[model samples]
Target chain A: MAANSRFAVAAHVLSLLHIHEGGRITSEYIAGSVNTNPVVVRRIMGMLNKAGLVQTSPGVAGATLARPIDEITLLDVYRAVQPEDGSLFAIHDNPNPDCRVGRNIQVTLDTAFTRAQQAMERELAGMTMEEVCLDIVNRP
Target chain B: MAANSRFAVAAHVLSLLHIHEGGRITSEYIAGSVNTNPVVVRRIMGMLNKAGLVQTSPGVAGATLARPIDEITLLDVYRAVQPEDGSLFAIHDNPNPDCRVGRNIQVTLDTAFTRAQQAMERELAGMTMEEVCLDIVNRP
Candidate 1:
């Protein structure tokens, strides 16, 4: 199965908004850059809108970043596009309680998984959309 | 979609083997502990086997750890069950080259995503099956 690409697409959309700041940038325009369907871009925009990362109107042809690009971290974008649960790893369901290992493995894995997830999130938190846009603009 | 549970299941299977070290612990027995189908257990066992983490034979009812549990890190188990590509994040495909951001967003995202993925992996690498088993054994 394809890994989820919502985070990447969201970043792309936001970068485009920053690059074209002050211009009316439609979902169709964003989709063209992302090489995805406009509907996909709109759906992500809705999530970004709800997250307060972007501003959109019911019939508007364009969206804008709600905050300065420097204020939005990749973590914010990642969380906005991901499910609220947002766990990086999934523990198995319903281990046999009668088994000692099964009875406690979930909690054990949870502790370890949480650490790993936080480590990743910390890296994301350190990177802002401003940096991403800068990297894009500076790239050859 | 449910987060992939193969990592949890693989860990469970390995823990079972460690707990029942000397006995002929069949796939059905491991499945009982995991509360999943025997086929599921066998399928993961196949992956663990191919990863050289376990020793299994055709028509065998049980498997054994290929190395000491202390030597098997969660990262090892994680990589064993994950796809060869094994990137934690997926960048969207085919951005429009005509667009400046599109031409460079992938490379920028790749750098950031790699850092996040590596941070998570390093945490996993720090944890071994021994610690997990110990955690399970010590749980009240």
Candidate 2:
């Protein structure tokens, strides 16, 4: 429930771009599709623009992927929108360090999360945004 | 920085059990080791015990795994502690369902998350908790 908004936002934005690949689509239109405020879309666009995943224009303009959708994996979009985290999971801090187990709880968690995320990324790396979009298009 | 605490607690508790195997341990001690309240340990213990991952008792009691440490994969621990997920990645709610992508993002995201999580579990299944513990015990 608490994963984060960036991944979702990135997906939404990419889907919007896929729908309007040739024509420049305004953030307002994208936000309308996402049901979120245009300002939020714009903010995320600014970050993606900085990350070079997207090319943006000023005033009533929209953004599009700097590269082809076929070349972008979910991991590419994820990394562009979300910072690289070693593990997909995070450890709860303030563990009882006084106890031996507490002292190593974070350590153990780090290992598990890191391994799990690496596994997830390896799988995700196999698919491109085109594949995702194609799947959506072909869906019944 | 955003990860769940469930696995953290489970792994810590399990590691402690392995460290002090053959000896009964109490939730209070486990909680102390996890740096959480005894109540928290007790709650987790209830589930772990049900999953046959651990055993527990009343007063002057602690918990231990039902089987040897080598038999428990991280996947076993994860399944034991996974909480109810309201949404996979917290995609925008109230999205314009009339929009094609909006109508489909949820479905697509859920599928992707499922696949990603499966890949993660497969990876976790490859290693035992013993490997994790040894890494720690042997850590310099």
Candidate 3:
């Protein structure tokens, strides 16, 4: 159960599209750039497509960005691939109810964890695909 | 891996110690509350001990918190078990260097991820074990 690498992979796929905007790129090409399999790249792309961050057509073998890179924040990309109800941290289910602390731990942690999630989202919102591409292109 | 439950598990171990202040508790007991194996509890406790958040006597049978619950923030617990130099998000290594995006993705992602990590730490810093335990105790 490794931390899902989908987010990293999604970002990489997006970066490649940004670098090669208007170019018809297949999942195989994206997979090669990401150094992962085409299936993984396609899965992430599927999520990205559902989120309307990217566009794909049935019978079409290529993909493209649905919006300008500057308009697409990391937060948007993160949410695009993130599990709808999953938290950054998960409280273990079914703690011993006989124990007072166990009986109440989940609720307690849920509140704090929500705050932590919001904090991370705020940071992600501050970064966009355009800035990421600029940083990469400007690197020596 | 599996989103690293160390933070939640560590908090559980601490809350139990707070509820049973001055009482000697074994890893097996904590494991029972955590619904996991004693080995896992011991591993997490070892981290807490190394962080100076908890005290363990060599050859002794149990452990306890080293500081007041209020003084032990979630940040302390997190740092105690977090992999040093690990980021919340990891950029894929060896992205196709021939591609401009691949050449610079790591550096750009690293900068953005670092900010996200700091934000999470800041939020964790604001929460203490005392607050956590109080919330649990006060729950209906």
- Which candidate leads the pack in DockQ? 1
Off by over 4 Å in 2: A1-5, A83-86, A92-108, B1-3, B86-88
Give the per-residue lDDT of model 2 (tens digit) for A24-93. Answer: 8888888998888889888888877887888887874857689888888887776777755435555667
Lowest lDDT 10-residue stretch of candidate 2 chain A: A83-92
Judge candidate 2 at residue A116 and give its lDDT: 80
lDDT of 3 by residue, A20-120 (tens): 88788889998888787899888899999999999988668768899989999999988998874758787777778888887888889989999988998
When summed lDDT is taken over every stretch of 10 residues in candidate 2 chain B, the lowest stretch is B83-92
User: On residues B30-117, what C-alpha lDDT tens digit does candidate 3 reach at each position?
Assistant: 8888888889988988999999999988667568789989999998998998865656776676788877777777778878888988
Q: Which residue segments of model 1 deviate by more than 4 Å?
A: none
Compared with the true structure, model 2 gives a TM-score of 0.86
C-alpha RMSD (angstroms) for model 3: 2.2
Candidate 1: residue A103 lDDT (0-100): 96
Output the better candidate (1/3) by TM-score: 1
Q: By descending lDDT, how would the candidates be arranged?
A: 1, 3, 2
Order of candidate numbers by TM-score, starting with the best: 1, 3, 2
lDDT of 2 by residue, B8-115 (tens): 777777888888887877777777677778788788877788888987766647566798889999888878887665233566676778888877877887687677
Q: Pick the candidate with the highest TM-score.
A: 1
Write the candidate numbers in order of decreasing DockQ. Answer: 1, 3, 2
DockQ of 1: 0.88
Please give the distance, in angstroms, between residue A124's alpha carbon in candidate 2 and its true position after superposition: 1.4
List candidate 3 stretches off by more than 4 Å.
Answer: A1-3, B1-3
